[model samples]
Target: MIWLALILLAPLGAGLAIFASRRAPGALALAGAVVGLVGALGLFAGATGGATVSASLPFLPGFPILLIANPLTATLALLVAGVAAAVLTYALGYMAHDPERVRFFGTMAMFVAAMELLVLAGDWITLLAAWEMIGFASYLLIGFWHRRAGVAGAAMRAFLYTRSADLGLYLAVFVLIGAAGTSEISATLVTTGTPALIAGLLLLVAAMGKSAQVPMQDWLMRAMAGPTPVSALLHSATLVAAGAILMIRAAPMLPPGALLAVGIVGGITTLIAGMMALAERDLKRLLAASTASQYGLMLVALGAGAPVAALLHLIAHAAIKSSLFLGAGIFQHDRDSTALEDLAGAGRARRGIFAGFAVSALALAGLPPMAAWFSKDAILAAALASPAAPWLMPLALLGSLLSGAYMGRALRALWSGTDSQAREPVPFMAAGMGALVAAAVVLGAGFGPLEAMLGAVADPKSWIVPAMGLAVGLGGLALGWSLAPARLLGPLLTPARNGFAIAGGMDALVARPALALAGTCERLEAWLFAAVLSLGRAGLATGEAVRRTDREAIDAAIFALVERIFLMGGRVRRLQSGLIHRELALAVFGIALVIGVLLAAPLYR
Candidate 1:
């Protein structure tokens, strides 16, 4: 419980502290990240193999702010902590020369905290809240270079697009609460069918937005406007992966048709984005597209009812892609360019960075003996077991081929020339890349342990599947290498380059109109408020008139009666004189007068 709280709060606390301080925010951020890293490892050790520890807060009634360390959460939490630690370590060197190190470090800390909470959340409300917080953090990080219009625009675009999908998640929560009377994941999963199906579908839409699926994917490409570490964090282990995790968590409740739909979308995104990566001239853009394509592949595994396979691919992709991005960043920092053409002889100059890049790229292409190769094959095998196996297998293979083709293109650009003047990479950055590369190797070598972990949840038929996947991955890579660049299919390249234009079009058409409609509603609300105020003023005037009329009538009558009573009392007092006989006569006369007045006033009249 203490470790979990530290993991969630360390970043947030550090962020606040850094912002409050006037100097060395980066140092403060790094220190906080170190603490978080330790806490994460502690939590992992304390709750290995799905052990859970929970505590309730006294303040939040009924909610408790629970944190569970199930296998899934544990795995994701480790990933978040690991990446954040690596990135923060890298930032120690990367931001040393930057002017806005304070803002950068502070925002990074906040982002880490949000991501940790997202993985730790046990209920849908907590998950959604953390999800939005991460989105907020991304918005700040993406636009870190606020001086650049493109960076700011990209950040806004990402925020708007994801928020639109978040609405679907919100609706899903409502549906679940209405149908199951609880937002707890366990409860919702237990109440499957009908409304649950609808909830699943809505959740898929939210996943699509976050994962950078066809219609909501363009923001990722534009997101390259941010700094490289931001890119690595967003593309590799954090933002895009969150959507896949959400779907995986809800797998038990998802309908077959909905799952199939998820598979179909994933398959299409993989194919399209892979093609785009092949045509991309910018190295970072290529990587961005590749991230989308890879995420789509993971989604395919999830949709095919193979959560373990999806998780395997996710872990492999995270490690390899982080290294690749860091390598790309090193190149860009040296050359001040992300264009692939500008990096003609980068490989010979930066041998270590290029070597790291190549290893990761091969892993991404699912080459043999690499972590991705085994994991990807497992997904294909899972798909084969599904009813849509025939179609899914072909699509997965095609995506693999495209991934190989683009990766080959990148490799050729990096290694083909022999320029000696290319710059060397920073030590800390290389260390970060090296760490991820080592992780990839370890994951690949220890496939047995990973397989065992996954097998506990599902079957482990490893031999044939791994062999076939390796063969296909290697075959694709060889085919891509042997073929001449000019002979590559042109029309397919165009579609890939454009990423089906789905993400861009959706942004311009759907998201823009929705934002416009929101603006219109704001105007309408202002008009309504004015109208209500005018009506209120008119009602107040009418109320004042009614009050005045009542006051005039009631007060005038009371004053008139008081004057008459005073005159009558004076006439009665005049009868009560000085002498005793006179006083007796006056009293008798007063009594007679009162009797006469009472008789004459009513009965006589």
Candidate 2:
């Protein structure tokens, strides 16, 4: 458990050192990787000696983050640590001239450390937390060159797809936990029936999005826009591998229905992605498509009831594919492009690197003595022996054949071009690629023992299996070498080149809907703005009307009444007499008028 903590923290600390300090980031990154690598090896040693270690720290009231050392987690930890160390080492050479080593290596370290936590997670809560961390780290690493055009978009697309699928993971974890009353991954394996089925299928959805399976696969090829080390890391053992890892971990609890669903999805994705690879013209994009296809094969293995087979392939592919990508990075450095046309004869120029690349390619094609050949045969054996052999076997074979075809095409193209383009070898880069190529060459023989460690046995007596795999692999290579892709792919040629768009790809699913929503929002915003302006105008008019009414009505009436009062006062002043004679005459007139009125009143009565 202490080792696990160190393994997870080493890269994390290195990442902080890279970002937070002004010193040389390469050394810091390398140190972190070395520490993590040593810790993983120690964990592996402990596991082999029949020791298990687990640690739990409080997270929720009852649910906690669980980290454990077991055969599966330890092996994966070693692989992730080793690959991350190698990629970071290679990046030391690759990014020597680039100015952003701090940012690049920092994110790389963070990404690697996150993967360690993911692999060593003993409970769903830890897994879910680590799952999100990986997505964030990948986003940062993939968009490390944010100044580059289209890079931000590529990063966003990758993030959106995976983040959306992450919903399934959230749902699945709670589902299993609800059913089993525990968040511990090992304990949740006891969850069966409908609950398991629902969780398993939900988990598959998450896997598909992360692994670049089918419709979600479009983002992966575009992810090639990132730096090559990013490509190598993302494809090899970190982000893309997470989905398949989840599937393998949860394989025990999946119901047959969910398994069949996973298998069928895998089979379909393998064929289609292979077609895309065969049609790809960019070296990195070709590798990206192949990554999707390879994971598809792993899914098929899981579908065929062989998680061990899938695990073996996963390990083998981590080495082989990273080597291939590293070699491509060297080519990209040489030609300043990954396009097939630009890379023509790149192999001829960099013979040593090309040799390593070719070895890994052959290994990917499942040739004998190579890592994938051993793993691929195990997957084939699993598929062929499964009850669903009719679908599984053929899909696996088609994927295998296509793998050779595209790889052979790449090799021939590289070897045929001029050697005018030469690149100076970077020792660190060479060392990194060399390590992986060696793994690609020798890891095949280790799978049987890996299975033994896990107590799973594989079929060994199927002689026909190896013979068929070799023939198909060699045959695909021959055809690809001799033929043009235009002829080989035929109708698939155009569609695959256009990214196999379904109903106009993003134009239909994303762009059009997004545009419509934007337009609606714009119109709504405009209307609201207009309505606000009209209200302001109305208020001004109302205030003016009130002012005018006060002046014209109330003020005018008061002033007119004041004028009448003044006129009445003047008339009364004129009627007033100031002489004594005027007062006597008025009194006599009043007496006469009173006598006349009294007589008239008596007659009326």
Candidate 3:
């Protein structure tokens, strides 16, 4: 538990330190990452050693924010830490020449810390808090170089898209916690029937946005406007990974109805995104598309009731994808552009970097002995064995086929250029890429132990499963290397590349409608303001009438009475000025008048 806190705090504290002191920001960031990496390993070791680590801090009344070290949480935490360390290490070299390294490193650390909080969260309360944290942190990181035109807009697009989808997460958590009577995530798995199904579908909606599945996939490509390390971390195990991780963690609670829905969504996303990868022009955007496609495959695995397989692929893909992005970053640095035409022959310019890049690319293509090869096979086998095999299997194979094709296309484009200018190697950048590439190459065989640790043993559908996957991958590679992606995809290329839009996706469907809704709301607010102003004017008019009534009618009547009183007083004063004899005479006259009146009254009666 302490280790988990360290894992969460190390990056966060380091980020704050960088922002506060702005001194040796790189060294501070590196130290924090290393400490965080060590702390994550410690939690992993402690979990496997049966340490029973758990902590509950007061968060909500009767709903504590829980953080615990179980096989699942610990393993996920390790994946996050590993990827963060690698990405940050590379960023040190990548941003070495920048003046705002302090700000950059600070935001980067904050981003990592947010993910750690997410991965280690034990209850819905903690998860949701961490979830928002990661979203906010990603926004800052994505727009870190905000001076660049369109870069800040890209960040805002991502934030808005995900923020809108995050409503689903809140709703799902509300359902689960209400039904289960607890915020504990594992406890909520006991919630069955309609509520569980409802929660699962809602969770899938959130995952789709975060993972960049289908309709939500557009933002991931646009996100390339951010710094390269941000891209690497975002795609690997932080922002993009959050969606798949959520689904994986919630897998046990999903019902058949929801599961089938998940399968369909995943299948559609993989096909759409894989084709987009094949058609992408920008290297980073291409990799971004590939990330979505790969995660689609993970969703396919989870939907097929194989979260373990999904997780394996996720871990392998983290190392593989981040390494690939780092290589692209180096290529971009050398060529000053990530456009395929500009990046042509970039591999030859930095042979060592390309070597690592090729290894990861081959791994990403599902080549033998690479981490993704094993993970991909597991997914294929799981799909073949599942009830939805008929629907999922074809999609899985198609996704795999396209994965290889796009990867091969990238390789061929990079290696085929005629220019052969060479430059001295960047040892710092190379070291980071090398570590991840090595992991990508060897992490496959390591999955057996990981599976055992989690007790999620693999059950391939005979030896033929892996063989079939390998054949499909190789065939895609051949097709990609020999033919243009447009020719290979034929008619489907344009739509898929354009993100499967109906006349243009987000612009036509989502953005315009959202803006229209906002406009309507604005008009409504304006009318409301005018109505309020009209009411105020009417009240003022009424008050003015009341004031006039008091001043003209009431004041006139009072003044007239006052004038009469003054005249009467003047008469009395004149009487008082007379002698006492006059006063006596007046009193006698008054008494005589009273007696006369009494006598007249009697006569009248």
Candidate 4:
């Protein structure tokens, strides 16, 4: 419990310290990341074999901020912590010379902390809060270069797009609370109710948005405007992966229809994004599309009731993608260009980088001796085990083929170029790549332990299943290479370039209508206000006329009353005498006059 709290708060605390002591923000961030890393490892070690560690906060009496480490949480916590550490180390080198290094490091730390909290959260409310925090931190990191309009715009789009989906999660939480009488994830999942199913669907919508699947995907492509390190963290480890993690975590509560829906969407996104990666001319954008494609595969795994497979794929992808992004960054920094055409002869100049890029790319393409090969094979096998497995297999195979084709093309473009375009590699950058490549090789070659670790999570007869999947994936790659030179592939290339028009069609169909409706509402509100103002003016004129009439009547009545009062005063003054005796006589006369006035005024009516 203490370790969990430390893990959750360390990065946040470091961010605060960095803010207060801006001179050493990078150092503070590094320290916080180290602490988080230690805590995560401790949690993982303590929670092996499905053990759980939990603690409740006193401040939140009825709904304490809880952190629990089960096999699932431990696995994710380790991944988040490990990647955060690597990224921070890279950031130390990347931001060492920047003027706003403190701000950069601080935001990055906060982002990492939020992801940790997300993985540790035991309840829906806590998870949602962490989810928003991650999104918020991502917005800041993406728009770090605030001076650039493109960066700012991309940041806003990301925020707005994700927030739109977050609303669904908010509603889902409310529904869960109403139905289960608790916000705890465990209780919500165990309690059977119509609202529970509804809440699950709503939460899935939020996951889809955060994951950048289908309609919400354009924001990610735009997000490339941020610093390359930010992209590396986002695409590889943190922001995008959170959605898949959420879905996997909550899989037990998801309705069958919801799962199937998720699978269909995932399959479609994978194919589309893979194709788009093939058509992209920019190196980073190609990687961006590839990230989306890989995430889609994870989603399919989760939807096919294979959380372990999804998670393994996620971890594998993170290692390879991070290295790819970092490599791309180095290439861009050295070459001063991100365009594929301009990168000719880069391989001859930087053989190490080219080799690193190839290894990572093949792993991403699910080639042999890479982690992607094992994890991706598991997903395909799981899909084959499902009712829609037959149809899904072909789609999965096609997506894999597209991924290999594009990644191969990218590799050729990088290495086939002349030696003149490349420069000497940065040591730290090369070290990062080498570490990731080593990890990929280890996981790819020695997947036996990983499979054993999965234990119950692994499907029955998994050995034969996964091996068959690998064969299919490799065959697709071979076929793609053979067909690469043919003009007949043009249509497929166009479709790949457009990512099946999913994001583009979403913008035109859904986003535009919502915007148009908002615009119409604004115009109608203005017209209504103008009409109300004209009516108010007319009402004011009528009120003034009535006021003038009332004022005249009041004036005449006051004047008449004053005149009567003056006459009465003249009669009363005569009764007052100068002397006491005269006054007494006047008093008697006044009493007699009052009696006479009363007798005269007293008519029976």
Q: What is the TM-score of each candidate against the true structure?
A: 0.83, 0.86, 0.86, 0.81
After TM-score superposition, what is the CA distance of residue 101 in candidate 2 from its true location, in Å?
1.6
- lDDT of candidate 4 at residue 356, scale 0 to 100: 83
Better of 1 and 3 by TM-score: 3
For all candidates in order, the CA lDDT equals: 0.81, 0.90, 0.89, 0.78
Q: What CA RMSD would you report for each candidate?
A: 8.6, 6.1, 6.0, 7.7
Q: lDDT order of candidates, best first?
A: 2, 3, 1, 4
What's the residue-level lDDT of 270 in candidate 3?
A: 90
lDDT for 297 (candidate 3) = 95
Q: Kindly give the number of clashing pairs for every candidate.
A: 3, 1, 0, 4
Off by over 4 Å in 1: 58-61, 422-425, 445-447, 450-464, 482-486, 502-504, 514-605
Poorest lDDT segment (10 consecutive residues) of candidate 2: 506-515
| CA shift of 522, model 3, Å | 7.2
The candidate, 1 or 4, that scores higher on TM-score is 1
